[model samples]
Target: MTMDSPIPLAIVGVGKIARDQHLPSISRTPAFALRAAVSRNAEVDGVQNFTDIEACLAARPDVKAVALCLPPEPRFAAAITALEAGCHVLLEKPPGATLGETDVLADLAREKGVTIFATWHSRFAPAVQPAKAFLADRAIRKVTITWREDVRRWHPGQGWVWEPAGFGVFDPGINALSILTEILPDEALLRAARLEVPENAATPIGVTMTMGIAGGGYEIDADFDWRQEGPQTWEIAAETDGGLMSLTGGGKTMAVDGKVVSDEPEAEYDGIYKRFADLIEAGESDMDMRPLRLVADACLLGRRVAVEPFHE
Candidate 1:
């Protein structure tokens, strides 16, 4: 992998995200060249496509890098195979089925001397970096996250999202935490939570939680729901000593004291790919698990209420 040559790359999982974001981002990034795709149901034009990760790796030995967009259940396994094959791996957010799995993958990557990027696309929203800068010197009093969406609109027929380890509402909610954690000056610790789980689903359809910020008494109120109809909301606002700072449009827009500061069209996946290239070139890995840990903590400490069954 020389500085001049584009690194040969493969993408595992040709689902919605692959078509919607990953492929476009890869096409735009000169640091990588799409060499193959691994998916049973999808194929890339003018590129070698395989049915599975194993097949992809076997067929495309020239590919030294891979982006995994698989579900959490099999994410660790695919990552393990890629690492074992000496490829720099990029994992989609929430990393794996459990915190422990992500930890193990990190250790394995370290041992193998391969870079593993557990990418949080939401954190790459244009305003996030600026928000982080703005809040670095300010004192925050409270943080509130409002994330709501209709599952049917976004997920469509994605039934696995309601299963165990699917994280239900936390699937989208983790993006909020990722952005919040990225911009906040202090770390977050789960205080308590209440989740509303549908009768037929193993995960929650709604959640409300309180978190404590490190080194300060800043309280964080997180609200996530998948049952929201009509207008969807993804906003995080905080009251600070300087003023009120908010990141709306899921970190794409930043406002200070009710005035819009930064509002830009999102290119989150592009940022993600650029970061991945930077890490690969520098022989480093960026795998932050704080957001996932928060979700896990919520599940550990949360009280679940049975709700009406959620039908697709």
Candidate 2:
């Protein structure tokens, strides 16, 4: 097939992530072309750009796929629109604000014979595959995660993150859950949780949760905070057979028995694009909502706590 005949892909919500990760990865991958980008106030160098998705779709009907990098609140509508337009969709993390909405999109994609990839980019981290292999047969007794970072450093002046529908701390927290679920042998459930919302913000700035898994009862205690002053830490340590397994630096490094096993530079989004290409070639869809489901459940069941107001 010719290059022009390749899968035409579009990107919605051309925000920081879309420019930083998605665009670079898509450019390097052969399976897709940056046919169009839809955003209210951004434009690509050469590819077609639109202020709205409908305009893009109408102008470029051959676009077979859309990658949604919008905030979780408005993701469902764009995803549904893409699916209805006979295009496969790849959604950013926290697929939708509620699990029910994502479920509907999944079903609609199936009915439309189009793929819906609810991507958890963290799961594609370099160390995650090895971490999953190391703990496959071991008995996981307990797991602890510390995911703390300065929101301003990572998110910059993105005001939407503190809004009611933005999911705030859970945004990064859900990434940890995604990796946990992928490495765990059995499915887990949220046992208890505490959320600390800023007095003036609609979303929580900090969260702590305990999760329990079936079959021998593995436990996971997770902490997410946006007030870290010094170095950011994204660590997951588990007490398992043979010794302790720890994945640190957000899956960029791994250790067993305090001995370094895997430490590599990050290429998570590159792997994601490769996988998307593979899925398209195989005419398959890869959508897993387990991680997002856990987040929604936590929101619904978690205890609310009041914290001091956060200011930018």
Candidate 3:
């Protein structure tokens, strides 16, 4: 699409993520023009706003694509509707509530002959590409990821996070998994997992998992907790043949052999829009479900433990 004649795009779900990331990125990138938005309680400045996805799609038939930034539990149906309407779909991270749902959407996209991008913005971080390239020829022996932050500080009164179908700690943890899956040398499976749920919540507040890689035999231990105090920590460190490769500050900084290599201002959503533009141009889908798959597997097989009740 030419710069003047951008692809008409609509956003389903005008939540916090939609406003903070999707709108800004779409505005900055020339690939897409925000045509409409669907939400129950919000509206964009100049774009058409609807209370439902069907109405949005029906009203803007010219919208060739849609971005679903709502919660994962309600994402599948909207995505299916968009794809069946002959519009490409861009899904926010964690794809769906379950791995099965994402698989279903993927199949539906194929049947409809439209693209479905399961976007993991963290994977598009500036350092991730270089880090993946740096480890192209190395053997990774171990990996450790520690993602701890205060939920009240970041999510403040988001009750859905504590629901049964909602992923809770896995919400942020999945970002780490997305980065790990992208940078790892081989597919990995969770060998063990322990989830600590607050007494009053349906979802866990903390989780610890151990993952095993294929033939090369690499182990990854991850800890995700929402009870951290003071400064937050989001880091992934891997021990490989090329010394130690660590991604600090949530993939914004990269270090190898105790020496800082690449550090840049965060622009994950910008990169995501750029990639979406490229995918639209190439007429291809860029959906990867491995990270979500791992999360599902962990939930399916993990042992649950009760903890103190959490209060917002």
Q: Which lDDT value does model 3 have at 235?
A: 95
Model 3 collision count: 0
The prediction achieving the highest lDDT against the true structure is 1
Deviation in angstroms for 38 in model 3?
0.9
Per-model TM values vs. the true structure? 0.98, 0.96, 0.96
TM-score of 3: 0.96
Can you write out model 2's per-residue Cα lDDT over 156-251, one digit (the tens) per residue?
888898897799998998999999999887898988899999999889999999889765477889999999988999999999876899999899
- For model 2 the TM-score comes to 0.96
Question: Looking at candidate 3, what is the lDDT of residue 100?
Answer: 79
Per residue, candidate 3 scores C-alpha lDDT tens digits across 113-161 of: 7778899999978789878888778988789999999999878878988
Q: Which stretches of candidate 3 lie over 4 Å from their true place?
A: 1-4
Q: In candidate 2, which residue pairs get closer than 3 Å at backbone N, Cα or C atoms, i.e. clash?
A: none
Number of clashing pairs per prediction, in order: 0, 0, 0
- Assess each prediction's global lDDT (C-alpha) against the native: 0.92, 0.88, 0.89
The alpha-carbon lDDT assigned to residue 251 of candidate 3 equals: 93
